[model samples]
Target chain A: MDLYSKEVMKHFRKPQNVGKIKNADGIGKVGNLRCGDIMYLYIKVAKDKKGKEIINDIKFETYGCTVAIANTSLLTTMVKGKTIEEAMKIKKDDLVKKFGGVPFIKIHCSLLAVDALAEAIYDYFKKIGRPISKELEERHEAAEKIGEELKKHHGGLFKVEEELHKEYEK
Target chain B: MQKRIYPHTTTRTENQRYFNRERRFLFGVGVYLDYAATTPVDPRVLKRMMPYFSKKFGNTMSLHSFGQEAKADLEESREEVANFIGAKLEEIIFTGSATESNNLALKGIALARRSSSGGGRHIVISQIEHPCIMESAKWLESQGFEITRMAVDKFGRINPEDINKAIKKETILVSIIHASNEIGTIQPIVEIGKICKEKGVYFHTDSSQSLGKIPIDVNLMNIDLLTASSHKMYGPKGAGLLYIRKGTKIEPILHGGGQESGLRSSTVNVAAILGFAEACRISKKEIKKEAERLQKLRDKLIRGILTRVPNSHLNGHPKMRLPNNANFWFEFIEGESIIIQLDLLGVAGSTGSACSSIKLEPSHVLLAIGLKHEQAHGSLRLSLGKWTTEKEINYVLKVLPGIIKNLRKISPFKA
Candidate 1:
């Protein structure tokens, strides 16, 4: 399948915010080593004058296919200036739509971006000892489960998507 | 031939500017380094095949003068191909493709032995064989034959002793690739063949990639059955040869018309066979000198890439490999990205990742050779051919390091 969309290709050719954020507030890493795709998301959370937490700066480092790299690039662009709450609401579908659309086979890549964002936000909340909501808690758990699943299938027989699908179904 | 032209609406200056912009977007003169995949038919072979299309077109089975002429050409071509491989003329059986020839060898031998009084039910093949052989082994498994896939070393070279250990009292045949298309590692066919011979089991080698690039004497190698594809050695596609030793008994895969001495039933593609014979003749004459030239180029490419690119490695055996092939694994960046970037520079090559499948999987060959999934996914195969020039190699050397650096810049792997 033509897994990479033209928009994805554009982002891949010129990815933005593709490094670590020093002394970052939160870090989220997701991937299957067997699938040869890994993405590390770094976010620097800042409290504005209103005392609202915002993702002031975000960066990513990815080793994967065109779709995986592009999704990370798009996710970073998406959450850079948004409040932590707003970033939590950014769904995988939104990421796919922002990049025109990815191939059906590559929807998991968009999900990876969402998972990284959720995990990062969860990390931020834990660091500050803030009360995490039920929704945020659920997202964090799902992202954590994905991380565990990826590690479990480090040298898996099934494809990455199949393993992830089974985990989501569970 | 018909000549055609399109009406142009742009002025000369506009046309020039447009072409310049287009050229900037496009890669340089298309450099094809995927010869292990296939190659363009040699013009000389094409020239010899022209008359057979219409002028001398006849069914070899017919009794007319036209049939006699076609028959004469077919026999002569068979003799040429046989001479090229040091086999007798009658030992060659023409098939549609290399894949077909492999099926005929593997299935044909297995089935033939199944019906025999003393024939066994076990077969042995290397883990790094082409898909055709692998699939054939799978089929044999369903047909109640015991199949053992021998493991290879890190260099993708299978040990002859491994074959010896894998062989059993019921082992009927052993088939392995003469040279690997992905990693370019040449198997120890002579030693393995001797093993199979000593064990009283038939030996088959798929020489689709190695036939013309290296020397092969079927009798000397003790190869009972050998497969060769025409297109891999500058011959036309749609024609391949299976060399069945004169006394080897094998069942026919196809069942009609009684062509190819009833071993293969379809009417022969006369023109394609002629082209294949011409290719074989030329390859036999040019192989030694050509191997020397391509070996120098292959070494230069391997050395340049390994030395220039950090964390880069050679995939196959260092010295005992095909003279035309050089495969590598670059750390950090995946192979698909490298291929796409190389395509932009007009360099055509291949990767070990089976990304084209329904599920993205690294090459089984690479995995069998002990490369981690991540390393296997980042593999590249640059296979040179007769048309590959030193200038093209230099161009690749000039542009490749820059592409690797750019890809590594965006990679998540720190190394």
Candidate 2:
């Protein structure tokens, strides 16, 4: 039950760029406190040479265990220099690779970070009045499904909407 | 208290130096606040048992002088445990563990009742009982004996009224934990035992957490069967006891040489039993003073955590908890994170949520007390012990707030 890798401890000990981004172009949040993990991904979007949006700045705030916080920290660092499409390409496995590997029980933390990143990119697209693509919509749905599955498995006490509202107040 | 904040932007070296400086103040004791998990064997108890391991070792059942000597010491050890709980010499049956004792109590009673009497094959137990009791109940259910799990209140107290209602014509026994190891809530066993007595049903209590820490009188509580563990009370781990009142019929769970009056069959663990008796004697002798000292520390810890860490709360009953136990829920931060961070800071503790279990369920005790699954996952249990010093408590109180604040800063959820 050594659930944490050395990388997880390292990132958690020195997590980079924590806290919310003010007036960020896109913000995505996932997880509930009752479920033992909550991740918020904030991205500042900028355009490169061919008008492709790049994730110029990224940050995250999380409340979770070592893997959850580490994956979020690593997620921010992994996606900061990538294009919005590239950031969306970051999957659960990529974060697991960065952590060496997480225990099976903690795979959900990596999934949460990937979900938040996808949702943040979705926010960026919606803000620019672009029609959401089918793949992006499916990724968002799948990510939402992970949260739902977690709640069903873990037996959450607060409704998702209510939990999200409480986080906003904080 | 002035709010002390460490900026998140501080260098790793600065944080390390700060923790090292705090650690140096504590003289390398490495604060052991997880006493509820298990305790180091007291030196006195170990010294008393060392002779039994090699010097005077002999089979208690053998028909020889060597055996007679061992038998004498075994009976003496049993008498010590019996006197500690105000039970008769024949009442205590030594077993391997509290888990084993619980199994014997529940299953043994259930089987005996089913075979001998046509009355009831049902049993009653509180939801807050340890997993051993719950798992034993589940096994009994599979064996065709109905089990009624009584619910506890928000403070983890099982209502006697609920117990009275739950008892039925077919009910054979009722088992409750005298004190919860997780949350430290003390049940009103005397009142429950009285109700059981009026109904003529047997009452069993798992007093593993309360026996050495608090006073127990089987006569006053009307407890017919009780389970106690030695490891929890600063003795060796391999020894436990099940106290069966006279005339209580329980079928033998293990069949062999018929040791322990045919209830538990195994060659007695002489060394461990001797150590257990020594632990019981010491606990009985010093219980009052130790209890008072721990209560002061527990109260100090509860108040410090609650006031210094905003959104933190004490779990279980405010006044009815164990003298050495303090459990708290720190909102918006996971319990595992708190425990791990505290460990890194030289403080050892436990989370109500068990990460190593298959299902990873939050503490059943916390869930039984009406905590949301999220809140349950954020709970911490810090148990004081005989060796816990005021300086260790002070160091923890000072350092823990900073850890919580840092964790909250990175947490996406806020309370």
Native contacts present in each candidate (fraction):
0.43, 0.48
Worst 10 residues of 2 chain A by lDDT: A153-162
Best by lDDT: 2
Predicted candidate 2, C-alpha RMSD: 7.5
The residue-by-residue lDDT of candidate 2 on B79-102, one tens digit each, is: 999999999999999999999999
How far does residue A13 in candidate 1 sit from its true spot (Å)? 2.0
Instruction: State the DockQ of every prediction.
Output: 0.30, 0.36
Clash list (residue pairs), candidate 2: A34-B374, A62-B410, A62-B411, A62-B412, A63-B411, A63-B412, B120-B170
lDDT tens digits, residue span B1-415, model 1: 0011112525666655544443334324777898998988876799899999889999898899998899899999999999998999899999999999999999999999999998899999989999999999998999899999999999999999999999999999999999998999999999999999999899999999999999999988999999999999989999999999988989999999999989999988999999999999888878888898899889999999999888899999999999999999987677877777787678888898634334677888999999877678788999998777677888999999998888777765542
Per-residue alpha-carbon lDDT of candidate 1 for residues A70-132, written as tens digits (9 for 90 to 100): 899988988888888888888999988988887686788788888888778788889989899
Model 2, stretches more than 4 Å misplaced?
A1-3, A32-35, A49-52, A129-135, A145-170, B1-28, B64-67, B354-358
Looking only at chain B, model 2 earns a TM-score of 0.92
Candidate models: Cα lDDT each: 0.84, 0.85
Superposition-based RMSD of candidate 1 using all C-alpha atoms, in angstroms: 8.2
Which predicted model would earn the best DockQ?
A: 2
